[model samples]
Target: MAIYFYGCVTMDGYLADSQHRIDWLHQVGSVEDTGYDDFYKKMNVTIMGKRTFEEIQNLPDVEKFYQATENYVFTHEKELKVKNYQAVEENVLDFISKIDKDKNVFVIGGNSLIAPLLDADLFDHLIIQIAPVILGKGIPLFTQSEFQRFYHLDQVRQFGQFAELVFSRKAPLDLPIS
Candidate 1:
């Protein structure tokens, strides 16, 4: 499972505004530098929380929005009907484990999903689109994680209201024999 993250963060590192809103995303101009369009093309399966999936539904051209690939949603109650979507109640790891690791898996979310993968050491890279707004208070794009490690910055690009940051997890340090 080649885990990757795709989403944006505020200037202050928050994912959404105080109301848990991300209306600014719609106003973002078309900039290929973000690599979002390309990322979508490479992904075979998408995983997201119900709330995040619902937000996508509210956007215009919902069907066309996710026409790129299959979707696997992790939700408890809501049932969504999409030709390429399957809802799973199991933990993210469990669901992720079921998929063939030979293909790339895109973990799409506001934070809930990102935090888990980061904690479990499952992600291979992160694609962060940082919006130029400081949401002093809101759901942060990266919730405080307990794990402490490093990520090598791969690339950076500036767009209209967002800057794209690509990072790959650093190699684990080799411990000396005690």
Candidate 2:
């Protein structure tokens, strides 16, 4: 019941800069101490893409996520509206398998929707919150899928000094089929 993949990366991995500006996370310091408002109060569902939901719809009190959560917008563009919008634009893995798998989805990103959900492995965890500053290039936080994925690093919370890393997705070994 956890299909996570939160964000923030930049030690050299890049998550935005060469025009995909994030403004350095509000010039670094106090994203509510990086708990992100307690991870949006333990999210109930949030998936983005369509340029990170139009960069959170050009934030400036975008009604603060319409109070609490529930927003999926993958987009292929077709009058993409937003009230508390929902327009996946057809079969993104069957619109993420019809959501509501007991809630707690969250895939938030813009690498073309995390490159087809990490090549259909369908994610599990990848909290990530490095952010130190180093954009030798930009808009890259995993998206060239050739499939060699294997994570399993669990937690590592550091805060203010940054370092959140938390991965998990290493299963599928009994080699002999291809």
Candidate 3:
């Protein structure tokens, strides 16, 4: 199974402003202007944090938006208000490992959830769409981590004012047997 991270970030590499607001994203462009629909079609399952799920809840017809995929929200809450999404309280790694091998999992948001998978070298792909505007201070897409991982740039595309970059995890080098 392949795990993907597909989202838009500010030019400064932030997911949202300091207030946990993504109002700036709306100012740049619309989903129709981006390649979101094309990417969404390939996913069989989606995983996100509570904050991301909450943000989706605010949008109209939240049920129909993610109707195609099996949704999982990483939250401590015993149950979620949404009908389609299932609440997950276990360790992220354990939960991810249990997903069917044939499923293509898309990570909606949450740097906290992304970082751990990245550190463990489990994230297979990263598709970041960079918006032209920069927020001086905001919630970043990445945080300090103890381990370092590498990826190779596979493709780059432009959708209006946004630049989309596609990266894939680099395969580990093979050592010759003595």
lDDT for position 168 in model 1? 85
Q: Write the per-residue lDDT of candidate 2 for residues 55-161, one digit (tens) a residue.
A: 77867766567466777787877656567757677756677788777777777777777778888888888888987888788888887569677778877897896
Tell me, by lDDT, which candidate is best: 3
Model 2 off-target regions past 4 Å?
A: 1-6, 9-24, 27-48, 56-73, 79-88, 94-121, 124-127, 130-151, 154-160, 172-178
lDDT of 2 at 25: 62
Tens-place lDDT digits, model 1, residues 1-178? 5888888877888767777677766565544646678788888888988778777776566777667777888888556765456788888877788889788888888577777777788888888888777667888877747767577889998766678889887777632334
RMSD of 1: 2.7
Model 2 whole-model lDDT (C-alpha atoms): 0.76
Predicted structure 3, TM vs. truth: 0.94
Q: Could you report the Cα RMSD, in angstroms, for every candidate shown?
A: 2.7, 15.0, 2.7
Arrange candidates, best lDDT first.
Answer: 3, 1, 2
Question: Comparing 1 and 3 by lDDT, which wins?
Answer: 3
Ranked by lDDT, the better of candidates 2 and 3 is: 3
- Give the least accurate 10-residue stretch of model 1, judged by summed lDDT: 24-33
TM-score of 2: 0.31
The worst-scoring run of ten residues by lDDT in candidate 2 lies at 169-178
Q: Best to worst by TM-score, what's the order?
A: 3, 1, 2
